[model samples]
Target: MHQIKRRSFLAATGAVLISPRLTAQPAEASQPGSLGASVTIEREPLHALPRTQYGHFLEHLGRCIKGGVWAEGESEDMFLGGIRRELLAEMRAVKPALIRYPGGCFADGYHWRDGIGPRSQRPLRKNLAWSRLGQKLGPEEDNHFGTDEFLRLCEELGAEPQLTANVGSGTAAEAAAWVEYTNGPKDSKWGSERVKNGHPEPYQVKYWFIGNEILGWHELGWQKPVQYVETLKRYAQAMRRVDPGIKLLASGTFGPNPNHAEIHQTLLQGAGDHFDYLSVHLYATEWVAPRNLWRYQILNRQRRPSRGLYYEIMAALSVQQQYLEDCISDLRQFSPAGKPIKLSFDEWNLWYRGYSDLYQSNFNLRDGLWVASALNLHHRYAQELELANISQMVNCLGLIVSTNQGTFPTASALVFRIYTENVGDELLPSQVDGPALPHPTGLPVLDVSATRQGDTLALFLVNRHLDAEVSSRCTCQGLQVGTVAKRVELHHPDAFKYNTYADPRALRISERSETLKVESDGAASRFSVQLPAHSLTCLVLEAKNL
Candidate 1:
């Protein structure tokens, strides 16, 4: 792991090194009559970008657990806890802030008891979530990877464990018991059971989700808005009785829909005081077909609209961000006085049609750009979005894909690495004045977020344009720019390009030193750089006088 230098800023100069495949047009081919994009960074600091925003999720579905992180058979390279040593190493490298376990609808039907106790004695149960619709039921869950194992994995990776308790098929007593086992004192009954399970000390997990999408009809025991709110209150009350310090996240909306409004209203009115965070899930997919069968048939017979899929996804993300803000406002209006509710975007990613049989999504360079933009959105809305988890951590919409042979870090993983490594502590507001992109609702060609820590500042930018490279001038108002500290770019010639085991380097991050020039007047220093089309870049700079 490369340690990020805390105090110093490094700079890189020249045109960004672009992959030959992606750079079909020369840098001189700027849009006709287009002015250079300019970004102004405000000195006033927003709240610290919560570390918890850099979290990941893990579910029991598919190879994410049984074969991905926890290998069944022992090998020389396996960790002592029977997990894949290679996966652990990869997870540690990203320094994920949290890992939500046993879910994404799976939690709604899961029975915590089935996973506790001796592995040999653990029973194999049918997984109702990840199975084919009408063919075979889901695979058998051996109950090998349960609560304890999850806590251990979090410990190994220095991540907090965010457990989603079963509210669909399990009762409040069961949820309370799981909490007791995890955090109750030694004298408590379930705590004693924890000792019997060979863990004498409590896991002291801080984050817990009440349920996993219980309002969705596809969930195991889907409930109506009112019913789910009542259940959430009961579960939150019971679990808090077991451990009062734990933070509970109530399952929120799927998106900006009528059900979303009703659900949030009911939860805030009925159970607002019980939970700390409202969990929401966001997944974007390109328009594959028309809504009507005739239109779809006609469109399919003609030609699929391949262009602007990336921009469409980005526009959807922008809409989702607005929806989230509206939800937060509703929470404020509905909650009791002095009680506040924040957002936990626990599930988010670019999920589309091409998923493997094992539920793994083929993440591509376009997806990496989407991840970068989505992360910037989170940072932009950092105040309301207290926590977020990128759907799954391994093999299932994950940044890292695990196989029988080894683990491969996807292009999206490099985005995670870059942000987690380079982003500063406090988010600073930044505005970009640039030419508009044709798609994705005419969003600016340059999307940016800035962060500051003492004398250092980091800028994260995503050029949303598909065909034109953006030349942008950045000016920091309050801070004097001394030097360029580091420049990291993640891009490829082909937006659809993805990483595979055969050629894992197909889309990866590149680092180069770029020149930084101080403005002649020295009032506010500026830097110039060209942002590649469909790319994400991070630039670190040092403050001159601080």
Candidate 2:
């Protein structure tokens, strides 16, 4: 039997050994010893560079609508500092290229006209869907934040506005008029009215969605596939006639399956060419765990529920992907549009629990690292998937969490902010290798992706191991790598260590660097990296181009 030495074992696996005697260097040291031998890496070029805007979304659910962008005093006259400046600043910091608004299910029952006009005149309608505490039940639904408010917020945030037209419980005319109000120039009545409201500028938001999740009616009423598609088609036609520059997206099903695929294919066939993007939702959690306690529950929620649980989830993801494939596949067969229809995975997060009356949770360090891992998945698959949002932006499973007094960045948000900034736009070629190391629970080793910005190459690594550490060599192919420019890691002894506004550092990308080791030859260069078990790290490599 081959016996591994203690140092070799520790360095190879990149672990934080629980045994008291197993100390190497401090956790912050670069040369924490070495494994038995060096590993060789082959070269490969990354492809299908996606635009940065491929990561964004909006849903007027949870605190996202009430306390988030729709702050209290947005209007000139009806002002009271309702919007959270700090929260807005945090979101702006993310540099979202586009933001869809006004609903998740909230879009289904929304009346755009109600959210317009004078606050005093705006009628009070019972928010049947999201009001868990019955907060909007009394006099709170006076409609403080309306169309004008959202447009202004968009401008302030420097993001493209993606408004969802009311399809369920609304007519095509209502959707058209709303577009006219936002995009129409000053001469028209609606345009003039917008000018009179305080701002004379036409809010030219070219991207719009016909409806949001109309097929599912949990809180809001549901529309059958045919009805939803037809309504969306009508809305698309009228919206385009008013502003031909508009980019529209049809609502795809919740996940993968023949039913969902048929729904997407049918919808696309009816209104495929008219739209520019398709919307879908995905969440990683134990929601799909099997009933057998052992079968369903995995030690790590970040990974799929062991192998047994993923059987359903992967099938679901496959269903969603096939639907997307079919939409474009079918559309291309008929319409000769230059660009393929893109995907907007607008609503997604690791939602296992915590969706209750409040719908908010302070994600721990493990959750944060997982958030980064999921985002890395987005970067790797950027060719097909574009515009992915981590569900709620602020409170309520948001990247950033809030309190009645103040707000702070969540672990997930921090990781996302770091990953996005470095990897945006600079497309390069990269790849991952290592056998599929399955956990005792049966999930495979973590996933990773790479990209480049200028001469800087970014390597995003994720370790999905729960109880054990993974020993794998990550080798970048083809490029001549220099010293490691920066290294940021998010990890903790416990997966549940989270950040609070007062002590946000409780669990974070606690340490980072602009230094590392790079070795190469005339043919190719490689940077050595060790991903901590159950953690995520980004290795920045500056290439020496010949």
Candidate 3:
């Protein structure tokens, strides 16, 4: 819909705003989609780009917790408390910034208490949301991987824990007590229970969201705006009473809907001063846009195997960004000026091959490109968007898929390695200039974002086009660069070939320092690289101001 509107406006105007960088010379235009692109970067930093933006979401659904993080039964590479040593070791390799846990829709029905006590004694409950409302095709919630184990995992990986409170089937007091149990003194009721559970020290977990998706009908206790705000307010009040220092995120929109504006309006008009952040969840795993997303999420099947599905999925990044843009726009309209709520994309990923066995979907190099490019898109809005968690850290919609046998890093996991290793906290504002692809809308074939820390400048670029390689010319506008220190590219000829434990090289990162050519033009330092189709490139350069 956003794309249609964008294209219609472009068609009506008889011109697409090429942003000065996207337009090419007539001589360069002779080749099919030959885009003479440049990355004109400014010297000054935008702001502190939060590492939390590259956070992860680990749910209680399917093998995401069971076989994904915790070894299902018994394994030699197991950590102290059934946590897989290799899984955590691999996770640490990519550098998980923050981890949201226990639920997606599962949060609504999840009772944190059942999972906290003795693993053997802990009660087995219905896997409500993830298992089709407790019909129980697979095993029920075994309570093997619970609160303390989760925090232990967090401590192991050095990642912050962001727990979602159950508002769907639980009370405000329950939410607050969970906070107290984690962060309160041992003398307190729930905190004493935590001590009894063998943890004497407080975890001091800082991030807590109200619920997963309470606004949607699929949730256990879906509340309308008028009622939902009061529910949020009550939960916030209770939880904050326990730990005033804790940050909170409210359950937010799933996608662009007609109800989007009004819902935000009512949420703010009612609980304007309550939440620290408004949440958002989006995915490009689907091929076509659904008329009814709530139903579509459940239907869980690809409708469009159109010849252009790859491009459509790639182009959906703009739609995802636009969703945030519109959500924030609506938020600003009704939100308090002084205490403005930020954004938290707590649940998001590429998940379309709907479940049969453990919800493991199909993937290829295309998904990897989408993940890297999607991060690039998020980098552009890093100022307003503080945190985003790619859904399912392990199996369900995970970047790292594992089992009792062994584990292998998915193509998407490699994307995190490039960013976590090279991408910095300081955002170096950049623009990608290239040819426009007009299908759903006019969008550039090249996607990019830049950042610098200390002397190293990292350029994260993606050639979203499927066929042709983009010859990209880059320059730092107000600064001079010293040398092309490092160049890494993720590319493969086939989009569908994947890596297993036996053969993990089908999708991998290439360290090609020769691909980057550096030359000085008077005062400006310029570098050029041939970006291949369906590729993610990171150029780490030694940079200095002239």
Candidate 4:
């Protein structure tokens, strides 16, 4: 039988104590995949921007809150060392610019003070929205993991905090006080309390969400458009007076649907001017029949259509973009000079298909592919979107799964790691001019992101082809290439193979120089590369003057 243990093994000691078994995994399976020929990456002049809109969310539901990040009992590790280690690892992987917490639907009823101070002394409150017990889990949970803990974690993870304020079942004062507690330093009682709790420095987190999913059909029944707009306006104005430098995100409906559009329009008309960003939520799933598998074989038999995972991928993204465009258009109709507000997809992931329901399901191949596709979609649209959190990053709908006792990286986590590592500060321009791969259902041949590091051109390619490898050329004008440096890939024959503590390398990056080739200087000198079926490739080229 396999065994697991935890000791004071220090990778970055004093900072945190992660378990040893957590990082150990079996050897990667042998690689014998075919590497055919040389390919050229055409020289292109690039004007790219930082992908700041890349953000993440952490919720207090499922394994996310209890066993995922915080351990209640007194252990040598104050903040649950194991969970801290897992969080650090995930943060390193996703490289998220911002981290939103204590929510999804949980934020509406969240009390900031309930999860602080002494763990046992904190009272357990009713979590009406996302409790697994259908009632309070215990006497009332101590506020062991509260604002201080979240900000501390954010600081440790090198991410900006995106605090969600309470709107329903909470007054404007409680919300404003929270902003003060985090941003305010030791000039007042709350600030003193923050210092007394071990961190003397003010967090000064800049992004705040007024509330979450207020437009959902069965939300706490807080308000209709006019009321929501009024409440949000009051909350934003009051909170801004407390800390004017902070950016407030006014919640918007995810719509085109009647319910979403009505509330969306109302919120825009009511409080659009007082905010820095517009928040929206979207998750794609196939909750039925041939779409969702029989649970048992889900890790194996599941396969996305040759074209794409779901028809709704394009539809959902299109709808969200359209919604934001229309909302902004409506806003500009009145205040043409109003500050532009981009989309913050703070909550999104591959849900439905019972995949979301299987909280502890190991990261297998199918999940990894979906995660890769979703992130690719985000990179493609990064110009308009400001923040995209891969909803619930640990335990529940997580990129990594952990119990207070231990943790395991999932396929989804690997996808985030691969994507974040390859794409850099400059999002370069690229054209996937190959013949579009067609299926009974529509599917594009390639999913691509081009970026430049100095004069070196880097391309992140996701080939969604099921059978045939896609052969294509990238032509960039007014630049010269010296040599093709390296071509690396993350691929496996079984798209669902997962990394377990026992075998972590099941789906990892492999390097092969033979898979790429370059021919220099001419219209016919365009760089050509064959994107393997269902694989992700990163190609880099060094520049040379012609």
Candidate 5:
């Protein structure tokens, strides 16, 4: 069980030979100090900051399901049959609050009966784990966009469809008849094959991540956390004997693999009461090669993009927010607080696979300010993030990018459509005395987050200075600001500028509406904005209380 096959092929081909180097540092400019933010509008609330943490992953690998969100032999006009009405209007403009499906490591060699009925009677095979990580559309797959075309693109992006079952070459009765063919009902038995394939309600797919990254031996059921905790309690008791209100996530990891915390303490002492979410899978890569790895990714392939790969992926957002704050303190020291388990950043972004191509991504503006500073640490650890996708949405490392002449939106999907159009509802509490990046835990140069709702608030900034501008300031205590309704910016002076199909508004999303000069001094309300130098902002202020 020494499955360290070159750290599972450099964490499944984001081929890195070690990084934070495409070379070119110093000159990220602004560091002459002084740049603050003190938010703290607390009337009582610290948990839950979810927009499912801005979710969005959909894998069938590269061209993320042939030609980005399916539509192969071309045929658009009112879509849905080929589901690419511009990838459903840029995934209903990044309002996605969960969409993982069919796979990453192709859901343990998927086989929900070769993708449920009609699509000219499916059955073509060969797309085994992205045709062995190369997937040039060859490596066949006529299982045309299967599973009722991925729940009709999550029922046209209202979202929530997580579903990644197929623990390495399937079965607990074929993943419990694919959770009774998507949340069973109509006279059971695979829900009467989803009411004979034409869907009769029940797409009740409330998430299910069972296996993907099965303790990586380049996964395909790469067991070891004590035989994947009894094959995850025989596939969670045969998919809860066909749906016990779904949920489940499991395939977790929190390590540099020294038995990664004894494989998360043997999946929380063997299948921690079945599961509610653990599904980790990060990617802000490294480990380049002690082995060939496809000739060191075709002999060092990384011909562009720098600021040392944008401060080594914005210092891997403070090294994956200290590996998800030590994975929420290893889920409060290994579960059992009456069966709790949340944290499903079900696959993040920024890969290397030696400068991707087959996993297509040219995403920039420093990968949209590293996805708006990784959603300001998922809105400051949004109550242990039950789900947080974004591994793919269209092209492979997507946020919307596809070419043969269409689809755009990647300044990391317009910083996820300006944080899903400013989602707020409490989770506020900010404190920043900025101008950082001198390591040893100092990454800030103004990365922040604050949310509210009634009386609006929703701040969310990220100005990692490439040539200085910050000056910022937002003191606010317990709220009271009164005007400045929206800002939404996704600046670009080219941190490897993106948005192409011959310039899809060459780096768009500018939005405006200003007015915030508040100055109360009765111990709170203060404001002063001006952050732009490799930006990504979002204001919204019009507060209350005080």
Candidate 6:
């Protein structure tokens, strides 16, 4: 038997343990590979990267809301507000701009009334939507983390509250009342009820989602495209009657699924005039049978670079991006009046592998790289994507995982922070000239996106190569490349490595300042960077002149 460190053993076996630091120091510089790429970032801005694009989601199902975020027992500190203090601190650090609550499938069945009263008085209802496989009802949903709690959590985290209303089993009047309760004046009936619940002032939630995946077969109240269009229009009209100022989002297709084209067409034809944003959900995963879970795990452990899983995932995203563009084009044709219908990619992540339940997913270093690539895709379609949320904030495909000891920010969370915390405001046009990979979809091994915020120019590069590092040179055409301010690289020796509760620092981000030799050619400036194999790197450069 091999002798392993206690923490390493525990981590390998999926045990929780806390680490002293979230990120580790960089490894020593080594010989670079022969692959060379050049990224040219156009200084002229294309579009503004909306802060809401960095939003997160919180669903009522699983441990995401219950044990993960809201604590049940007494805390040593009263000010902790019954929620996990550590989770709260971690959320604050990541600084998500917006958080959508009570949802995915849970939104279809949730009632606002059940969650608003005092904790003891709140009802324990059966979660009909997100139940275990072969089981009619999932877990007993104790309405502990209801509307008030979600709003309070958002407030605590300094995130804008985006609420999803129940349209499946809920009445239009109920949906209207929820809007009133959240945004109406205290004199209003539902608003007065909200005031009585201790929040005298309205929560003033700005974004409201009509339903969640109402067209999917697994959804609680699955309906045809035509049926959902009418349902969405009714819900939108009623809700907006109460507060017309609130932005309404209608549930959209799962991206590029042929079966959903009708849904997209019907939605634009019928409900397009009512809603401001069309919400799309995408989850990337290599499917395997539930019975073959153990076998799949073994195979995953032994899988080689030939698997091409990473490239496949990136290519799939590109396909989805094209699908989104097609949807936008359809929207343009449907509403010739030029009524803008932005996409709200509210639920997205890599969630293929299942554990005790379908909602749970294991996050690894590869998943972090996948997330980085996904963020890059979002940047590519920044103009179309008004808002996006990484599904289930604390658990259930969450970026941060909660344990009994505390909360651990996973590899995905670090990637989220690296982009959400450091990426610039204005997205710049960037083109990568590099060798293509062997995948059927010939995507460059070097994936890159650039942004400019005032005097700072940030380049987000993802080396999609599974085995080889790329030494790349970046050229800024519009702006002169000044001194390198920060270079944050996230990579692990083994792509399979992940951050577990016991080893929270296993796959961590490493940040360091790099000396850049800026060569100025009459109009453009160029600098060099080395992207490690299977790594996500963000280089922030200070422009020569503001």
| C-alpha RMSD for every candidate | 9.3, 10.7, 7.4, 9.9, 21.7, 8.3
Q: What is the C-alpha lDDT of each candidate?
A: 0.75, 0.60, 0.75, 0.60, 0.72, 0.75
| Pairs that collide, model 5 | 14-353, 15-353, 16-288, 17-288
Query: Which residue runs of candidate 2 sit more than 4 Å off their true CA positions?
Result: 1-45, 51-58, 68-80, 131-140, 217-221, 288-339, 426-429, 435-437, 440-446, 467-474, 510-514
Q: Which stretches of candidate 4 lie over 4 Å from their true place?
A: 1-48, 72-87, 132-140, 255-262, 288-336, 354-358, 361-363, 404-406, 437-441, 512-516, 522-525, 543-546
Assess candidate 5 and give its TM-score to the true structure. Answer: 0.34
Full ranking by lDDT: 1, 3, 6, 5, 4, 2
Question: Which prediction has more favorable lDDT, 1 or 2?
Answer: 1
lDDT of 5 at 114: 89
TM-score of each: 0.89, 0.79, 0.88, 0.81, 0.34, 0.89
lDDT of 1 by residue, 1-546 (tens): 122121110000000111112111222323433336999987888788988999999887666776787786757667745677777877887889999988877788789989889999999887766553311224678888888888887887889889989987889999999999999988899999989987899999999998887776656677888898789889988999998999999887765565566668888888888898988876654432212234334323322233434455556566656667877787777766788788898877765432232356557777788788889889977887889998778987778988687677887888899999888889987898978866526677788989888888889989877667788998887678766558899988777687887887787788987777767354667778778877899998787442
Winner of 2 and 5 under lDDT? 5
RMSD of 4: 9.9
Q: Number of clashes in every candidate structure? A: 13, 15, 0, 15, 4, 4
lDDT of 4 by residue, 38-113 (tens): 2233345343444555567777765676656776452555444434554567566677677898876678878887
Model 6 score (lDDT): 0.75
Compose the digit string of candidate 5's lDDT tens values, residues 1-546: 233333445545333333423332232433543454443455445766767877888777657777677775676463656665766888898888788887877878888788788877788888766565344733478778888878877787788787888888877788878888888888987788888988887888888878887876677758878888888888888888777878788887733343456678778877888888887766665435435455345324542433444565577676677677877787888886687788887777776543254467767787678778887787778777757887877877777876567887778888888888886856777777756754434577777777877778778778885656576767777667775667888887776687788888788888889887788866578778887777877888777877
Of 1 and 5, the candidate ahead on TM-score is 1
lDDT of 3 by residue, 489-541 (tens): 88887655677767865788888665345677667778777788778888888
lDDT string, candidate 2, 1-546, tens digits: 133332232122111111112112212212222222123433444455555433454455556556654556543332234666666777777777666677666676678878777788889876644553345311245567777777777787777777887776677888888888898889886788888887788898787777777776442446787777677778888887788888887777554445655677777666666787777765544343222233223323433223332222222222333344654454445332565777777776655433331255567666665666566556655665766665667665577765455677777777776676667354455444443432232234555666666667776666654444545555555567777467777777655566776776687565466555555666766555666665777677676454
Query: With candidate 4 superimposed using the best TM-score fit, by how many Å does residue 370's alpha carbon deviate from the native?
Result: 3.5
TM-score winner between 4 and 5, please give it: 4
